[model samples]
Target: MELTDTINQVVNLTKDEKLSIEKYFTVKTLPKGGLWIKEGQYCNHIAFIKKGICRIFYNDQDGNEISCFFMPENNFISSYTSFLTLTPTKENIEAVEDLEMLVINREDLEKLSKEVPKVQIWRRVIAENLFILLERRISMLQSKTAQERYENLIKENGDILLKVPLQYTASFLGVTPQHLSRLRKNSVK
Candidate 1:
C-alpha cells in the first residue's frame, strides 16, 4: 500500500506536514515467526502491514500460547498500552507469514503529532477505533458460543481460515484445536 495514501486516509495533511510524515516512516521486513513486539519489552513502534499476517498473543504459565488477535494486510499492529505508557508489554506480536510493513517509532509519531495539528486528531481517531475493535472481541468471547464466534470470524474475514493456521485461529476464537475441528465439521454438515 502507498504510504502517503494510507497516511492521508487517517488525516489530511498540508504539503509540509506530508513531507514531515514521509521522513518519519520506515519500511521493515519480518520473516515468519519474527516478533515485532516481544513479551516484556517496550513496543517502540507501530506497524502498518503492507503484506502478510501476524498474531498478537501471550504465553500462559503453562507456556501455552493464546492468540488475542490477528493482523492481516492493511491492518495496524502494536502493543498499544505499552506503546502509550512506555512500559513493557506482556503481549508478543509475531509474524505468521513473511511480512512487509511500514513502521514509525513512538517518538517520531509524537513529534509529528506535535508539529502537525491534524496528526494529533488522527492519533485519537486511531486509538478510538482500536478500543472499539477490542471491545467487540471481548464481547464476542463473552457472549457468543464457540460456533457463533467461529461463524462471526468467517463473516468478518472470509479468507482468514485459509490465511491463518487453525491452531492460532482456534486460540483467537477461545477454543481448543479439537473444538475448532468439531466446529468446522459442523459447518460443513
Candidate 2:
C-alpha cells in the first residue's frame, strides 16, 4: 500500500495532509543480500517496504549473524532504537530479496510532523505497533519451544520459508538448519 494510504488506515488524513506527507518519502532500492543498515551505522530513516523482504540481524559474541525479525512488503523497517536515540545500530538489516521502499529521513519526518501536526498521531501509532510486535517476539523467544516457534512462523507467514533462506529461518526459530528441515518434514506429514 502507498504511504498515504497506510497513514489514512492509522489516522484519517486530509487531502492536503496526504500530499504533504508524500513529499517526505523518497524511493529507494537494495539488491538481494545488500545491507540496508549495517551494524554500527546510524539508522536515520524509517522506510516502508514497497516490495520484497529484509531481515534484521545482529552478530553474537561468537560472530554468528542471527536474524531476529523479518520485514515483508507493505510494512515498515527501521532500527527503532538507533533512529530514535541517534545512536549506532546494534543490528544489520539485509535485503533478503531485491527491495523497493519509500523512505523518510528523521529530519523530513520531523518537518512533516510539524507541518502536519496530525502526523504525530500516525507516528505514535506506528511506534506502538512496532512495540507490540517486538514484545511478542521477546515473549515467543523466552517461552516457546523450537517446534512451537516454527509452527507459529508457519501460521503467521506461510510463504516465509520460501522467501527466506533455511539458515536464517532456523536461526530466527532458535534451531539448527537440520532441525528446521526436520520440522518442515514433520509439518508436511
Candidate 3:
C-alpha cells in the first residue's frame, strides 16, 4: 500500500488529520545512487518511502562506507539525531534504486505537531520506537557474530539478500563481502 493509505497503521489520522498531512509533505524522487541526505549536511526532513529502497551509511576512518541500515517500501528514513536537533548529519541516505518518497520537513512537522494533536502524539511514539530500535541494533552488533547477524538479517527480511547489493548487506552485517559469500553458501547447505 502507498504510505498515504497505510499511515493509519503507524498513527491513526482522521479525515482532517490526513488533510493536514498534505500541507507538510511533498513528493520527491531520487534516481539510483542519488543522495537524499548527505554527510555533514543538516537533515531537514523525514521521508516515507513510496517506492524502491534507500541505504543509510557512514564512512569509516579508512574511507569504507559502512552500511547502517536499508529502508525499503513503506519505511521511513532520516538521520534522526540530526533531524531532531538540526545538527549536521554524520550519515548519508542514498537511493539503491530509483526512489519515490513523501517527505516532511522538520519545521512543517513541528508546526503540524502543534496544530494537530494526533500528529504530536504520533511524533512522540515515533521517537520512542526509533530509540528502542537503535538500542536493539547496537546491542545486536556488539553481541552477535557476523554469521549470527547475517542469519538474523535473513530471519527479519530474507528478500533483502535478493533485492539489495551484497556489498552493502555485508557492510550492514559488519562483515566483508567474502565472509558474506561464505555465510550464504553455508546457509544453503
Q: Which candidate leads the pack in lDDT? A: 2
**Tens digit per residue, CA lDDT, model 3, 1-189:** 765466677777788888887668899999999999999999989888999999999999999999988888888788999988879999999999999999998888889887787777667777887888889889989999887888899999788667889999999998899999999998888
Q: CA lDDT of 99 in candidate 2? A: 96
**What are the per-residue Cα lDDT tens digits for candidate 1 across 1-189?**
666666688887677888887788899999998988889998889888999998999999999999998888887788999999989999999999999998999888888778777878777887999999989999999999999998888888868678888899998888999999999999878
- By TM-score: ranked, best first: 2, 3, 1
What value does the lDDT take at residue 182 in candidate 2? 94
> Which number leads on TM-score?
2
Clashing pairs in 1: none
Q: Kindly give the stretch of ten consecutive residues in candidate 1 with the minimal lDDT sum.
A: 1-10
lDDT at residue 125 of model 1 (Cα atoms): 80
- The lDDT, on a scale of 0 to 1, for candidate 3 is 0.87
Cα lDDT, model 2, residue 172: 93
Model 3 clash pairs? none
Query: Tell me, what's the RMSD of every candidate?
Result: 1.4, 0.9, 1.3
